[model samples]
Target: MADIDLDNMTLDELKKLQKSVNKAVDGYQDKQRKEALAAADAAAREKGFTLSELTGGQVKKTKAVSPPKYRHPENPEQTWTGRGRQPDWMKDALENGQSKEEFLIV
Candidate 1:
């Protein structure tokens, strides 16, 4: 590319140059983005999934909620999934000389 003598250019010429430069930059960035997306799609396809699925761009199918495994002894309304941290009610029961096994729904 030839050297652009901005010092010798008129105000109108400089404005045109700026516009052309901005357009070229935008086009280059758009091309790169498209190429990246294509690569990601190809990789996802190789893994038996789509780019949308990997990126969560499509509506996600939610998993079914698991049934409660443990129920509160005193309050039958309270229940625990038995996956994460113990519930406050169960903790209180244990602290008050109650066994966790006693609260088992079985």
Candidate 2:
């Protein structure tokens, strides 16, 4: 690595250098992770097992989305899935004696 005279560099020059350094570091880290994973996969295959199987083949879990069960009377775009706490609009309407059944999407 070459010596950098950081104090002499202008702000723009420092920013450009910083960006270049960040890109280089990220690329190096990604390459290292890929190489490590490849080595682990090869080792697992040699032991007559796949990497996924040894790792339990687990995948990232995503929250299940409930379909919208209620919609605003005037604004068709505004909707609620009827799972969590009611929206302010719903609360206000209910306070004004509007029934929840009136807001049902069906």
Model 2 has an lDDT value of: 0.91
**What lDDT is reached at residue 61 by model 2?**
39
Best by TM-score: 2
lDDT of 1 by residue, 82-104 (tens): 88999999888889999878888
What is the C-alpha local distance difference test score of each model? 0.87, 0.91
| Reference-based lDDT, residue 103, model 1 | 80
Q: Could you tell me how far off, in angstroms, the CA of residue 32 lies in candidate 1 after the best superposition?
A: 0.3
lDDT of 1: 0.87
Q: Model 2, range 1-106, lDDT digits (tens) per residue?
A: 8999999999999999999999999999989988988898899999999888888986233588899999999999889988899988899999999999999987
Question: Which has the greatest lDDT?
Answer: 2
Candidate 2's error at 10, in angstroms?
0.5
